[model samples]
Target: MNATTDLLPEWAQRPVSDEFLQALTARFGSQCSTALAVREQHGRDEGSIAAPPPAAVVFAQSTLDVQDAVKLCEQFNVPVIAYGAGSSLEGHLLAVEGGITIDVSRMNQILSVNTEDLTVTVQPGITRKALNDAIKDTGFFFPIDPGADASVGGMTATRASGTNAVRYGTMRENVLALEVVTASGEIIRTGNRAKKSAAGYDLTRLLIGSEGTLGIFTEITLRLYPLPEAVSAAICSFPSIEAAVHTVIQTIQMGIPIARVELVDVNSVRMVNAYSKLTLREEPMLLMEFHGSPTGVKEQAEMMQEIAGEFGGNAFEWAERPEDRTRLFTARHNAYFAAVASVPGCRCITTDACVPISRLADALLQCVTEADASGIPYFLVGHVGDGNFHFGYLIDPANDTQRQQAEALNQQLVQRAIALGGTCTGEHGIGIHKQGFLLEEAGDGAVQMMRAIKQALDPKNILNPGKIFQLQ
Candidate 1:
């Protein structure tokens, strides 16, 4: 047996027998699968880097099933990787250590919607779109939209955020509580539905972005918001990239309550237009949204326009109708894939760096210049209003030279972000891809504290090992 496997308790090391497999089949007939191909498919996430398959796959349909599966894994000294929608960009779901994948999609269900308290409880496997659709008629909405229709459980696991994050806040702010299955098959509830409480430790916040390291989230209670009285979206073009970024900076500085403020470079604009079948001017653009009473939205729009004018921005192209706004934002949301589609058969390497507002322009300019000088085709898009931007590079991984160049550029970008007192990843958690960078960002002492917590919660190291940090 391998050193790691030898260390596992006897139960973990024993191979599944026909009887055991039959038992699993009897319990979860359609959900249990011992097929190598199926297990391999559920092992990795959406990242382009390393991928390791799990030993088995179990499609969990309820919290009880999750608890039982975890118990079985614990008895065998095997790892348990929690699987959601498998849309993670950072390889958070990759089964680095072979074991079992607890597929949570079957558990998808909206448990309850407490309209009176503006909170909803849901099974972890439920997708964000499903939840929104379920509550559409209630005049309430869950605003932590991450663009991909990712699962609520996965969003909570990664503390995900996207366009509306700048306004409605990320999962960290939306998740009020969680029902988690711990490493040892212990079920625990963290937090409550109350808006705020001074109660003990904030365990809910701790587990919000644990990425399945601390526990497997079985259910989540999230705060909700009433649908806005009015909503409007606009595309404002700028002659230069700097001008577009400056408009965002100034608008935010002026305290304009923008519902959404996103910056897309000219190159990305062309790609998006092509992918979405829209003929928009191929210029640097700021896609924005305003929400409030009709008059308030109009006033905000006017204020934004005035600020844009000072920066040489064009008149707003409004999308007032529901279908129009959906089409526009959907196109915007697909910018990453659109850029990837520009180069057929090429893989995408996306890197995110967040800097202080004062340094965002300089940082973005540095990235653009570096990418240009490296001769690597890339796309620049960002939540500029929040000083976080993503650089998507299309590379032929088969070409070693190109791969090295991309890595060099990524390292430089991350180092610069650290120098500027910013995080290596703004929203994406520190999965395996960013472990080294995370250590550098957190320093030895802080990293040590993180290790202490990990050990305290999972001494056996059977839950998503080889992630976040390398244990001593």
Candidate 2:
């Protein structure tokens, strides 16, 4: 078993010896599973990538359990993939080379809350919404939403951000420390609860967005923000997509302290209206939020309204009550699902690209024009305040031409993002579908450096093999 280089088979074709199986069974007992349902669930995520199920699933309940699973898989020279809430839009959960998936869902526990320091320690399995819920009693909250109630581990793994990111920043800024288990079964804790540090080597930042290729998170220590004293949300409609985007551009340029500013095209608004039973104006619109003192929130909203009106923002509505605020955000978060339902029996080949703030309108309009001209159905949404947007090209999965058309549009948008001095992906990481564009964006030299790091960390190539550039 120790002679992996000479004895291992080709990829997933490597046979799992009876002795290895017996060892796992004896050590973990009922925590180990070979159930078809569990394996299939861990094999894929919300993305459109097709992959084979993992050979087995282990429900990891603690950092030690994760260590045991990785140590055991290393003996058989098998891959170890981490699983969170299974809500990732990318194929981060897919076991492309068939290995053992460590389901961290059972490790959902909040370990500590340092209210004085505005930090909390939690297991990797806790979801964003759950974390906020758990800390609501303390008056401090975590701000990296990322739309879905994604696992904190998954969010940190992907370096996720959401609407609030326009003002509060992303996970990259909010995360302070992490506890990781390396491929060699060694635990590494990076950072502390302090607000600032002059530490050697920012390993926490390195592992945050590694996407489980470098190591898996066992516990996370995150920065927290106090709940705003006053909050306000508004919906504004524009005559055209360009007008709406221009408003966002102008608002950001003015340095408005908006907590969240989202853009929705007429098509997306129409779908949401039908699916959620809200008669929002069928025009390009912006959903905005502001947080501060009562007087400050009022001042911000008034300033935004004045700017919105300058750019043909009509039919503006405000949601100040808690119920109203919930309704507005719930509909916004459900937009992706509602869009898929709008086109019956269709799956989306989603596009996520971010351009320079000045080039936002150009990047968005070009893709919208092309998609409309191609006669394909799509729903457009964006965190426009940050120059990031998405287009869900809904197509029947069984239709060859539609799939090709969707992919073509996705490539065009990604290329546009890169050419405009921006990124190929703003939030959604480079999963299997976006791997082709990674090298195009990062270039050969940078990708090679990444590969070198991957090789140095996982020499066995047994940690989530075939992800983030297919190193070695």
Candidate 3:
């Protein structure tokens, strides 16, 4: 983990005084917990990064609850970390500076839905699936999946995207307004339900990817889309990863409106097969979906089939039944867990690098070659149509050497993506794990500008302290 150490913030944890704890417990009673188990749960996320548990945990049930917790922390000069569904992959939920975590999971609810306006306002803690389920009868659904049943607030904080991001945009584009609890415990609103607002600074965009550093989101208003009239999913296996990548690149370049297109490398395919009990072809595969009118879906499928065939892709399979499509996508989403399960007592250092479409082949191929040569076990998967992909390099938790090797591969991959005019992170925000990469990718001037905003908005630097960029 030495290689990863350089990516962490250079800050020491602040002590949580007895006075603060007593005050918090008095204010919230049972809702505030100092128990080790609850603190441990609030301290980490899905990623491999580790930290000491937060000093305390506050289970917030509503916007007022969050605001009160923030106020208490602010008064005590203690850092506050906002926690959602705990699905983040970049250590976003880690209490790196030893603060109290405000858990908003209990705040899950659909505040309002405007079907006629194609928008919905929700509590920060509602998961994407839950929101869809509550509004399924309304013939509208939110498209930002992020593979996890992550809280909508978490998605908004991290600007999350997933398989559907290719056609529909990421949270940065989909989120319309936010009700936020600021560092000083003041509640504020940014943006509104209107589609386009030439209004003041784009505070909504500013906070979308802030990773809980700018402000803690209590309520989020998001754009919604009507359920497609016709939906179709297909899978095609390629002779090699390059062939599959080329197929996707060509498909995107040709302006095909693919709803979702993902790549599963040979290694991931095998893992998925064993984990999901489905005998998919043992080759690099592209799982694709198209959404539109029946005729339009057919035309898109035909076009994809033709393009894939031109690249020597075969074993084309179509899944039109709802159950079949669900099964296939479930397998796809389970790829990460399957890989982890393959290696007992191991965690992975996942790299999220996205390059230009034309440079995707070069970036991916180089990373694959290096990962293969490094002798580190890894699984590759991607939302390739959008030139964004992930390589989860499995590393034994007890083996520091493997951790270093995985971090080296991640560093090389991020550098390659940056050199190719791409970003170090396409969807995952810069948590403690990617702080250095953010500096390298955004440079000092841009980062300083961001820091200035942070200083202005959170002068005390208590909002998810020790994340994104180092303060001093």
Candidate 4:
């Protein structure tokens, strides 16, 4: 083994003995995996970096099973990495110090939906799409959409958000409560079903974005929104990206309650159109959605059009038909994959930075100009309504020069974001990818407090070690 691998803790390095595997198999039956390949596959997430495989993979089917596994790991001094759908962009699910990967996909079930209370309880492994589909006939919707069909557990862990975050807020806002298994094998519910409370310590918020460093989520209670009376979608083209961004800024300043406001650059538009088999104009465009009463939506759209005109934006192409709107959004939702597919054999180094609304256009222009000069293939997309955007740098990983350039660009972006009174990461948690940036953003005193909290909750550091904050 390499020196880096050799330096891992004893429990992380020691192989899963045949005797232990036999015992696990006897206890969990068909839920345990002893194969090295299966264990390795379960260890890593969708992050660009590769990680060491877990010593074992346990397909947990219930809260009792998760509690049992946690207790066993605690007794054995083994680290536990909670595995959901493995769809996280950050290295949230990577088993850096190999131990056990508790696969929660089998626990996918919606426990209950309290439409009157505007809340739902579900097992952690349930995907957002599954929950939405289940509640579709109830006239309620869960709006914490992060584009990907990620598990509720993973979404809660990462505190994820997407286009609609401008209106419905993020997981931090929607997750009403969580059922988590602590390092000591204790299951606790952090919050209640009430609308508001002056609860003690706010533990729910602490675990929502903990990224499995403090506890393994077993269940989640999330707030849901009633279906809108009327929804309108539109695609507005701009002569330049600055115009589109300016239009968004002005629209927000004018108090338009836009449900979603997304920006797709010319290159991104081209890729999505080709990948989705559509004939959209290859221009810098803004995809907007307004939700409210019919009169309200119409008024919002009209006001937004006037603001766009001021910024040299074209007339809004309204997707009034339900099918047309779905078609448009379907293409938008597949933008990341489309951009990735544009370059054969390319891995995407996606990163995002948020800035103050007034400084957004400048920040985006700077990053786009730098990317243009870097001679690297990239596409830009943003939740411009909230001054947050992501740049996908499609690079051949084997090319050292390209990888280095991409890293440099990412660093520059973070630096600019910090300089503009913004965060290095807006919605994505401070997983391994953004750990260094966290230090840069949150000062030494703030970081020390975070470390204190982590140490207090996970003294042994057996839960998701080497993530978020490194040891002193």
Candidate 5:
């Protein structure tokens, strides 16, 4: 009854054969599953996209397992979708072409740690938080925390960046290398342990944000940082969103190495206050963090407070103790969930846009004003210091008009960002939701090149079909 196969590439636009399916079950034994309950679980994730469940779910424990699954799917030309922690926001794991979902969650492992070199290799299923916890005793931490307990492979696939990105950069800069399995099930290493390389064709960067469309990442080598001796967090309230954004722009422009500078508008703050039980002013606020020696942190905090005072920002409230800092950021990290829970029976649609630091205020204000005018219950959260922000629009899925309106608003905002010389997606890669934006952002020629590469690597068009780009 499912006609999704009609959209797949001509090479793979056919239903999986019964013989190959039987062979697959016989080969993998307990690792392969076809129960309706498990298939439904692998059908969707944190995203709002609707996708039919895959034909089967393969719980792969190793690269060879992934290769075996891929090879089996290849024989029957069934598309393959890789699954990790299922924390993707852009529907990266959706099995649009009716294929097999390869669940890699059981492959969690921290392979090796090179403390002196400040790098660590981890299996794709290892979450960022788990990796950090594993290396906590090593006096170093993996700083790319994308809020969710997202697997390193999922994060790498999405090229995720988080609150720490303002100071530490995103996965794009942190990932040193990757071990990937091509569509044909051949395993290949993209980079080495060396910090820098003059290697031909930067393949690691290509696969970093491919969102499992190109190849599945088996292992990821990531850069790590020395844990700060003295870490401190501060919250500053502002008269308006503009003022708070201006302060972030000014702070970054002044070359201050603020570890994390997050902006939460009054709406989000109100929800967070109720959710986190924090008694703070219901005004636009910035949650900031600094990492350094004790004296350095003190100096940084003082300097930031001084700048905040210049832009109608209230006196900074500092959280110095480890316990206090944890509680503060935990609330900040829970903002998205807090927002969704604020209203009953409401699902959230998020929009991501990033502009030049100087243009952030304008872009953010435009989006805020439009969302405010739309009469939609929305909350604003951003990494303002880096000019990337997200609008969480709470909607009733039962109402089709609200969903349509939100989609239109997102399109307008993305166009505005492009007009202002910014990317359509700052962190969340272009899964099915942003494919149109990808065409507009990367232009025809670049998209063609991407298609060419996809065809060359996965000529059968079996790797996560209907993602990033729709092959003709």
Candidate 6:
């Protein structure tokens, strides 16, 4: 067993019975697949977590289809895991306990576009990029991009945030409403198209970052932003990571309203340069974006340049054209893949640590020192404007020592972030990988409350069981 699954109980790994399989087949003929290929596709995600694939895969194309399939799982007392674009970075998609995975990629569609209200309701399977493309001509766009073409369901499930989160917000802030399937196969809608409501409990907020443990998202309503009138992207190189990070801290403290600000360490800069075939300076760099009216964007850029200059940042480069901005941001998004390719046949154990803006330098630099001293090859990148960063430690799957070393480094990072008044995971939800840390960060009392809520909502323990926390 892998590190992620070793601690799970054997009872949770219940085998899928022929009775259940036959019932599932009878419910949906061709959509129900027991093929190894289909099971494998729905079994894993982008993380290093490993587990046996589910016994069967259900392709749910509509809300009724999801409701019916879930009802069958409920009847059989079997665990049900939701599947989307499969871009999750933590172990959110792994089937630690043997179960059936409901793939929602086929359900991708835009249900409604209300330009007047600046809101869009969509099926759970639509990706952020696809959503933007569908509404590009409407003069509005969704800004909660998590660096991947992650499905809206997965993003909402994890409460994901990305480079633009500094200005707009994460899924927690932008998600307005949801249509969810409860463990009992009941469809429930929470919140509405209207912005703010003080009517009793905020179930919408409760389910946003629950990581599919409480319910499965069938439809989501998101707040949209009008396209920025004027936008500009820039990159500035710094002598060291400290300089680059400090610039971000200052920019945020001064209220610059920078749209997106990302930090790429020297290792990542070199890797992305090689992978993207660009001749960028191999130094710690800050990639930034500004949005507003023409004058406001210009003013923000000028203020940022002055702050960067104070920290000895140099070689300010601008990418003003739309194509140029895409090229720069695309390279930033591919940094993870570039790091993986740096070492042949290597997988990554990534760390997501977010601290208060004032403590970011200490949290980041200390972690960097430990990583460098441990001799682990890794790439460093962050949406530093929001004080969240990731270190992708490349590890050979066959080397036990390397894997342990990476885990130790990750543990150290998490402990440090918690000590500094931060979270173990900034955006990546508590999947199988970080359950232990979730207890450490939130304490037993709070975690028990969460467990209580989970138990109340999913009495059968069939909704993505064995995630977030292990039921006692």
lDDT of each residue in 1-472, candidate 1, tens digit only: 1211222232223244555455556777778887878987787665666555776788999899999888777766677789888888777777766667889998889888999999999999999988999899999999876678798888998888888877888899999999999989999999989999899999999998888989999989999899999999999999988999989888888889998988988889999989999988899999999999999999999999999999999957999999999998898889888987898878777787888877888888888889989998888888887888888878886776786787778878888988988888878777766777887889989999989999999887778777677688
Error of 1 at 51 (Å): 2.0
Winner on lDDT (3 vs 6): 6
- For model 5, residues 27-75, the per-residue Cα lDDT tens digits are 8999999999999899898767666788899999999999898888887
Regions of model 3 farther than 4 Å from truth: 6-9
Give the range of the ten consecutive residues with the poorest summed lDDT in model 4: 1-10
Per-prediction CA RMSD (Å) = 4.0, 4.3, 1.2, 2.8, 2.9, 1.4
lDDT of 4 at 246: 90
Q: How much is 281 displaced in model 1, in angstroms?
A: 1.2
| lDDT per residue as tens, model 2, 1-472 | 1111111233344456767777788878999988899899888888776677887888999999999999988878878899998877767777777777999989999999998999999999999999999899899899887888899999999889988999999899989999999999999889999888887998899888888999989999999999999999999999999998998899899998999999988889999998999998888999999999999999999999999999989988999998998888888888998898898988778888988899999999999999998888999999999999999989888887887878888888988899998887888887666776888899989999999988999898888877777664
TM-score of each: 0.94, 0.96, 0.98, 0.95, 0.96, 0.98
Q: For candidate 4, what's the RMSD?
A: 2.8
- Of candidate 5, the 10-residue stretch with the lowest lDDT total is 1-10
TM-score of predicted structure 1: 0.94
Model 2 TM-score is 0.96
Off by over 4 Å in 5: 1-14
Decoy 4 TM-score against native: 0.95
lDDT of 6 by residue, 1-472 (tens): 1355356554358777899999999989999999999899988888887788999999999999999999999998889999999988887877888889999998999999998999999999999999999999999999997898999999999999999999999999999999999999999999999989999899999999998998999999999999999999999999999999999999999999999999999999999999999888999999999999999999999999999999999999999999999999999999999999999999899988899999999999999999999998999999999999999999998888898889989999999999999999999888888988999999999999998999999998998888888889
Name the lDDT value of residue 433 in candidate 1.
69
Candidate 4 local lDDT, 115-137, one digit each (tens): 99999999999998998989999
